[model samples]
Target chain A: MREVFGDFNDGRSAAAHQVAVRLDTNGLNITSEGAGVLQHWPYADLRAIDPPHADAPLRLTSRANPDARLRLGDPAFVEELRRKAPHLFLRGLAQPNVRRNAGIIILTLLVLGLALWQGVPRLSAPLARLIPMQWEQEFGLAFRDRLLAGARTCQSVAGTAALSQLSERLTASLARPPPLTVVVADRATVNAFALPGGHIVILQGLLDKAQSADEVAAVLAHEIGHVRHRHPTQMAIRVAGIGLFADLLTGDGSALAELAGQVGGMLLLLSYSREMERQADAYGRDLLQKAGLSTAALARFFAHLAAEAPTAGGGKLLGYLSSHPPLEERIAVADKDEAGEPALDAAAWQALQNICD
Target chain B: MRQLRVNLTLMDDDSTPSEASAPLRLEQRGRASELLPVVLLNTLLNIVTLSIYRFWGKTKIRQYLWRQTHFMAEPLEYTGTGGELFKGFLVVFFLILLPLAIVGNVANIYLDPENPASLFFPVILYMTIGFLIGFAIYRARRYRLSRTVWRGIRGGMRGSASQYALRSLLFWVSNAITLGWTYPWMQFTLFKRLMTETTFGNRSFQFDGSLKPLYGAFAKFWFGSLFGMLAVALLIWGITFADTAVSTRPDFPFSIAQIAFLLAPLILWIGMAWYKAREINLLASGTTFEGLSFRMDATAWNLVSLIFVNGLITILTLGFGRPFAQLRVFRYVCDRLSITGEVDVAAIQQSSTAVPSMGEGLADAFDLGAV
Candidate 1:
């Protein structure tokens, strides 16, 4: 008596064996012997066997008849096989094909390449649209006008003479005048921004926060570093790529807003690569020291900003912090070396603070 | 031995035709047993190659998992090789990553076109490509493992590449159409179809309709996201209210609201921990096969509590909470889970001794017990 279980493509050879016993992994297989003799037995018959085999016995294959097989005699083997077979089968099925795996890898790389190819052009389109060389001249003129207007505003806020005197001192200090103008904005946001073609905007709020003129100078010096490095142009180009990508994908003019939003988000979240930040910090510090301003004020300003009330909308504050090193860390680095005299006298500090009011 | 004569008598003339099927079964040990050595070897390789082995290590794990479970017959066999797959993936990935890297470098150079240092763009491009390709290979291998491991038994898993691609496309389309509500259903259907189609030896595969576990996983994920959002909102609200309340008095430098704001993240962390615990417990307990039943000995709540407590401690203690988490999960599976048959953890561990420590750590973390 033999049992065969499962679907075997090759089964005919098993029938040829005399006194053949076949065991199926799941059941039994039997054939008919005519003339009042029971031939084929079903899988259910195993249940009746004394100390019944829970699983079919292992089948040993014959070389001459590829399909012909015999069951192992040990009943224990059947029990153990039944106990573990499911897991074993699962494990076998789970194994990855080397060729298929390799194929998938290659396919994925191809997809990635395709995505980049598709994505980059979309990213670059806005930059291409904006960079016609004419925009530089237009940008420079617009920047000059804004700087002049800002200077007038500063004069109105601070006494004219004080403003004039400050400007004259700044101009005299520059041996090779940079191709840019700096004017203080009346706004109370503690921000400093650089315009294309060397125009720098310093907010009154930033000036009020600086305890000393050197801190104000530190801010200006950082802007100067940006102007010198052409950081604005680089930033514009980077943003333009993002904008282009958005515009291409959406095919909507409103995507310009999305682009701006993305750029703003990026500016807040992305720190200047460590080397870039270090270079800017070094340049600003060098500028302040040469101008006879103490660099310690920069460290003081960082500490002050860090201690400020965490901004409303955690997103904004998180955004700001993401792009900059931890304030305490930056402060520590600045305080490592103390050099030069305080750039602001008591009167100058008072005047700078009062500019916003 | 006595040759016992059994009566060979035909019961009746009406004999049912035997089903022509040859179902071959092979035992599969848990992934943890196989994963440990590969992980360890890769970690060691990583040290020797300055992180290059990180990519190779990832590929190796996928390959190892695939090989461990593969069976051509009753005695399982594996046809895939990690080295070959890794190399193939790397080559293809580099071809793609290199160009994008070039673009990044070119953009960097264009920031200052006249500088001679800009010529280093090609070198930067190549290095970036190499790194991305390595990472991509790792990702690819992982995907392959997850897909192959639960293959069904009938018709040997049918679906052409185009069909798969279409299915993936429809997955996204349906998600968009149904506003993400259909995601779980889609996932279930896809998984069931994939599992049922894969055939080996003779038996076909089938997934027991166990949507309860899946629903539990989804609920945990949803709750976790909700908690995280709530924490962020609370922080914002607290900060705003404090600013308003304190703005009138310049002398009031600090406010209670500020304290509330700071503690919001802690609350969010707890929520996340809870979610993770719930999710893991549901997934571990929910999975079952046809004609086979599985039961986790540990209560779901107990597992969840263990994870939450350990995770919180880890978070507060700068990542020292991992060992406790691992121990808890191990204890739960070893002492709690039972299949109707025998399981020997010690013996399984012994067989996996060739695996490295980090590999073992990962395997332990995932709780892939030996079969």
Candidate 2:
């Protein structure tokens, strides 16, 4: 029988250690002489040689400088060893052959394909439904309703037709009007929600806090961008589909309710895609310029909001700005524009700021 | 390959009697065997209750199996109250049954007339309505079950109820278009999505879509059925021919003919079973996990024989053979299919330690035990 041995550990050992060697022969009585001192070792005490075979019996002999002599009289041991040699060699060779990251890319592609197959067609109709032709009118009506409600609740209103007309003219000049309906809430929580179905609710506190009309318009335009893209609906569908898919695959519907409850909250904090935000910004600037308003007003407004609340806890409004470019970056973009015109004439600016009243 | 002969000689003098000592008894404990009885009993209880005790029985079965099969001795505790399941089932049942009953009643009253033209439309309408209701209930129950379990894990469920309803509708529509053959594949896809989304103690379960076993089973069923039909046909033909020949020629003895006729069926049946057993062995022989491996027992043929005999008896006795068939199949699968190699209670306990929560771990252990 052919026997091969390789050092299991790197050669740093100082002491001689007796190693257990196992040999299988076909009914062969094999005896060894001059193999150095023999030690009695139980089969169980033998160190596992990677893959252990139960049928193999191992024996321990001395590790000394000696010429070992082996006598094989019994034919059984020799035959058994010959028979098992091939399998042993194959196993030894297979130990080091490992595949790295072979499945990851394939699996990722498969998942992506499946997602698109399930999600794309379902997304089209809702996307189409989001864009509205009369966004300014809708926003006007919603704002008026909120103002009326605030008036009933003993909150002061600074309602003016000139402000609504200016907003209308500004939106009409845009390539694509923002779909969000503006609702001014009476509370001063400095929060706004781009709700599902083009409903944008802005707190009066936020309006009151704004130093310029451009700042308020910037916020409104961002929310309008969210509505136009139907982000909330998309997020809702994605979350629901993910939950359903998970349940179907694992047959474990374990945390589905928690997922459901988080959907609305997550939507409220929804981030629009970067492309959508960029498109909205470009559209808003173009609309302001066409309406004879200075593009720098948008920059000035952000500067005021940033300075007034240096450490604005953005958690509540993060979703509204999720898809938009960073505020500082957008402020820079607005500042680069040198349109020689006032953002709003004094009367329009005053009227716009008090429209929530 | 040369067959190897291993010689184990009993050496005397300066040695202990190793050969006389019972062959190294490898004690195996905490195996799935321990949990089998629990699962079987639970299944029996579930059957007895007409599935009313399904949730509780399943929970108990899972707990027992997990505890017994896992390396750890963790106990699984149910945090979910039975009331949730009860309420869920009630809602599901009413949702499905009420609409169907109302439609059936309406059809019986309005369209059951000697009016033949009204029959087609009402029947179709009733079926459509019934389908819708069944689909709704199924979705609702699914949602409820998922939500309830998720709540148990302290995670918020985030999905619209309407979306779930729509998904249910879409699933049915797709399934209907594909007929029922796509059912298994759809189920697999759906299951994969669901499990991937769920997390427990930060680790998520993954679905491995290995359909080899199912395909193997299907192949066996088809071949077995074909062989069985052929065998029965041959037996019938042989018996009739032999009887006719014996009657026609007095020189050809009746006893010989009768013996041949009887032997024909027996031989055919035995051959069929032998083929089945061999197929089962081919499919199951090398299943291994961790350090444990299994070999299909040859006794599967004997089980098949017993099942055939019982089935025959049942048919002969006009449907009275069901209990015997059930008992035999159960006993055979249990006794013949077993695992071997390095499967100890300690290993099971050790394997379970990595599970997140004790309860969930135990549940997993039970599932393993059942497997």
Candidate 3:
């Protein structure tokens, strides 16, 4: 290597001494003009501290005795040394090597696009189904208990009997009915939520707003449809999988479990996706039609909620609204659905309406 | 094309004429052309690997950053590898993520369901995590320092991570109890604690200076915040009075409370800016290593303007201007700060401590550890 100006540090303190560095058959040698002899480091023991930038301070240390440090003022000296011994430096993936870097870039983009669009969705679907029913039930029940712990459950005997009768009437037409347990919670929020494994919560405010039992049954049927489709599990799996994929790619593992926990608690609270909502509504319509109940009742309830939404106050109702995005197309389909007769008689409708009285 | 210049002054030393010695100057030599290519490649790799490329990608960035920083015309070096970072993250993920997830899910199931016990239990967990974060921050810094090499000698930190963490927690607790009035003392103590333990080669750093100089700025901020809060409370009371005595209309346009609410964030932002600038300046000036001291001539107003512009750019471009903003901030800091005094480098020998296998785990968890 050509002679170049350099600095030597003993690694003891920050004091730097100027020296001349050159490479020969005997390896790199250092000499101070006035001080005479400085140091002679063998090539085998010399370790190059690669600089990230193209032109940076050339720092090298002795592998055998790291306390010996050499800093070259000339980048050319580093270039010469690198040319002579490429094996001494660790390869950086981000270093600019046009042809190879280009290939990696192209491959990376394709994988990211594919994973986002198709791969993740395809993967999560089966994974969601694979989770055992026992786990899902425990998961669902645990979440539901925490969610409704503060709310009082209406246990009026007549109201309970009326609700059970209406549920029986509505579900009797199903091909294979799920084991449904419907509860009326004593909260004034105009909302209802369905949990995995056939648990449905209907708020008192929803019943108070309904003029007839058929209207309330229509809502329950929709929730039952959600259970039948196993939408909660699918939704939960999809969200968690996507998040984990992103985290793994970024090499961020620290917050993984914490995020998963947060997502779990919030899962039931998420209003079902639009497609799921529509499917649930369709299921309700078919079940109602089989029971000779009018689908117009479901359409009427949607319209009523939409009308009251603008006047609704507080963050509680906002949660309900966000989770249950309204679809006018579904409402129109609901209105056009034809059925033979009202399944609930006047007395049963009134009793169901007073279920939370 | 730009050329690399040695910038050698060639001035001679009279005391030791036999051995020529020169003064060293630090510089930032990063170029956009070099950085952009790496960034582009990394972005693509990040996309392809579904973010797995990021661990390596970050290494490349650090490599570029460290190389760009020159001390006495010699480029500082970064020897960290992408694979090492990836492995570190995975180890933490499997070891920490799984347990945390289980605990969190269980807590969410039992404690989140409206029970008073739920609230009380989660509070304990939060406090525990908060306390652990202190230790994690210290450990992360130690890791970073150990990884940083200059003139072949790596920088390092001493003292137990646990102790530092405990000290941080104590400060945090006191800050909470004292209505945040103990902030200056807390900041000063922590700065001294971390810096004094810092080492470049075998030599340790020294932190001097008192919070007595910062009290003036802090007091101004504290009083300003209090005034802002009182104004907000008064405005709320006035709005209620207006609603009752005057016209209780369906819509009350721009009441005193609404206006105060709008201004509260701005007030808080200003206070935070002032305190942050003063803290940074104090920290820089008070720190010394190998008989060399530092000075940061950055002012609060200058910082406020920098922050305002950075935020505006970020917002206007929808985050695309982030790199440019970051570059500008780096330049600003480098320009404003200068190291003074002398260092006895020839006397200092390489430290003989084994580097930690992995660190920055907590920083990764919190998403604040990257430097």
Measured against the true two-chain complex, the DockQ scores of the candidates, in the order shown, are 0.03, 0.01, 0.21
TM-scores, one per candidate: 0.36, 0.35, 0.67
Q: List where candidate 2 sits over 4 angstroms from the true fold.
A: A1-163, A174-180, A237-272, A313-324, A339-357, B1-371
How large an RMSD does model 2 have? Answer: 25.6
lDDT of 1 by residue, A1-357 (tens): 333222211222112122323445553344323323223333432221111223533443333332223334456445544453332222222534434543554564465445434543344334434544345435654655655464433644453344444444444466775566666668777878766567777778787776667677777777677666655555555454444333222221122334444664365325532334555677777777666667777777867765675452124456455544555556777867676776656766666666545
User: Each prediction's Cα lDDT score?
Assistant: 0.46, 0.43, 0.69
Candidates arranged by TM-score, highest first = 3, 1, 2
Query: Which candidate achieves the best DockQ against the true structure?
Result: 3
Please name the candidate that would achieve the greatest lDDT relative to the true structure.
3
* Model 1 chain A lDDT-worst window of ten: A7-16
Cα-based lDDT at residue A131, candidate 3: 71
lDDT of 2 by residue, B64-89 (tens): 32222211111111233233433444
Error of 3 at A247 (Å): 4.4
**What does DockQ come to for candidate 3?**
0.21
State in Å the error of residue B143, model 2: 24
Docking class of 1: incorrect
Q: Could you tally the backbone clashes for each prediction?
A: 40, 65, 20
Could you give the DockQ of candidate 2? 0.01
Off by over 4 Å in 3: A1-48, A51-83, A86-179, A183-193, A201-357, B1-26, B31-34, B112-116, B224-255, B262-268, B313-326
